[model samples]
Target: MTDRPNPLSDLNARSREVFRRVVEGYLQSGDPVGSRTLTRTMSEKLSAATIRNVMQDLEYLGLLGSPHVSAGRIPTQLGLRMFVDGLLEVAEIGDSDRETIDASLESTDHDVTNMLDHVGATLSRITRGASLVLAPKHETPIRHIEFVSLGADRALVVLVFADGHVENRVFTPPPGQTPSSMREAANFLNAIAEGRTLSDLRSDIAGELKRHRQEIDELARSLVESGLAVWENAGESSERLIVRGRANLLPESDEGAELERIRTLFDDLERKRDIAEFLDLAEQGEGVRIFIGSENKLFSLSGSSLVVSPYMNAERKIIGAVGVIGPTRLNYGRIVPIVDYTAQLVGRMISDRTKG
Candidate 1:
């Protein structure tokens, strides 16, 4: 496999310090940073000439940019990536923050969807930016399956997995099928589909139908097909994506002609498949992964930053990802830990629920 290239290389101590301060300042104020400003704000007592030389070295390294020659320097994409990877200092979650997170987790009921939604909204409020939560795609192995007919051609298919997870889908029976037919279909499924994943069961449903023709009437076969199709459609629909705090991105006039960029971003986010794929990438990494500016193709045009972490179940399977999105000027130092802590808390909740 080709290795990913490092964003920063060959910076000495002094140059790294200069680049770090400039990037931190730019992230704070969303402005080009002058050498004099760094000399004043940074704790180290570096001379303006020395800072300017370091800035020049950074610019040469493609880590810093000067929009106008006279203006101060700002961290380019390379600079932001470097700072995030190395110099960024994450603030620890304070007692109050922990209390708030615990309260949110404890107050919720057993509904995973509700818990994930609350997590997304809380993250958005905490970061003062938009948050995204991509929930699990329901990949657990099947323990048992049940069908409950609601009459009038509608029936509820209740799926129970080995992990004590239950999901339901409603399906319409093929014209004029009786509830007895539905019952026969349900019995046939429970007999043959136990301990199989939904995917496996779906592939073998037709074969089961053919083999059972001696016992099951045509009505039962029709109902079985309907039930299996409903399950397949519901499995396909399990990809859930929740986005909160989009309004937070709109008020920043300084985001430049990126207004349309934000629109495109929202559209892309609306496509759950893309968001799920993006979250899957983040899930492969440890801790929080910060995607700044053009580092990721999905939000590259928007000049956005994504701070993401995976939430996992007790079995250590990643169940989902939760994160914040904002302009590249986001407070990485603060939001990094926030995202990390939130992911951990979410993972804990999922694990606890699964164990219970």
Candidate 2:
């Protein structure tokens, strides 16, 4: 990885200390920090001239910026990244946090989707920011596919996988199909489709129908087309994104023009697809991954930060990701370990479920 530009690198020990103090103070208060504030709050004994010189150096390095000509300096994105990388100290999750997380994860017996929703809500409540949980995709091997008539030319296609997972999709039968034809189609599928993937079965059926004559009639063919069409459509089923704590964004007094930005973020989260895709990129790795402002293309426009970690299965395959999204002033020192610990908890829970 390329090394990041560190403003403090070129400074002496005292100068570096002053620079860090100013940045940390600014991060904590979300305000421009002056030398007087640092002198009062910090033990470092630096002359105001020396502090000003150090701040100027930091500003030149792109770590500190002044919103107004006379205002004190604030940590820019580069400064935040450097401070987060080297200076920030993360506090461990206390016993209360552990208890709360354990209670939330342990007491829930719902399906994966509901569990993710619960996790998102719990995380948002804990962090006071928007929380996100991406559900595991359907990747288990197919065990069987069954089509049941739901009356009025609609059929419910139920898919059973080797992991004992089942999902249902509804399909409308083609123009001239009757209930009898649907049953015949289901029977045909069950007979030849067992132990095969839905995609593979569809391909084989289509090829067979094109190349050779089979016992299946025109009506049965139409039913098969309907079933296959449903399966094809299912392939495009979007990934699930669960978000909570959006209302918290409404109360930020400092974020003026950012209110509209937050509104856009809420709308984007409602779509879920974009966040899912963003998490998919991060889920390819292990442990917690922090994406600061402009680091991830998806949220770069929002000028937000994401702290995400992948939850894995017993076999060590990534199942999903859980994270929090908020402004760059996000308490990374606190949220990083929180997200990491939650991801580990989620992975263990999923592994236990898979075993039992």
Shift in Å, residue 324, candidate 2: 0.5
Candidate 1 local accuracy as lDDT? 0.74
In order, what is each prediction's RMSD in angstroms?
14.0, 13.9
**Candidate 1 lDDT tens digits, 85-141:** 767777798767677777877888988888987898788877889998887768677
Task: Put down candidate 2 lDDT per residue, 168-277, tens digits, no spaces.
Answer: 87888666777777778878877876667766776788687545423312222333343421112222333222223335534543332234443454365445556556
TM-score of each: 0.63, 0.65
lDDT of 2 at 190: 73
- lDDT leader: 1
Ten contiguous residues with the weakest lDDT in model 2: 228-237
Candidate 1 stretches greater than 4 Å from native: 1-9, 42-47, 140-276
What candidate 2 gets wrong by more than 4 Å, as runs, is: 1-7, 141-164, 168-277
| Candidate 2: residue 146 lDDT (0-100) | 71
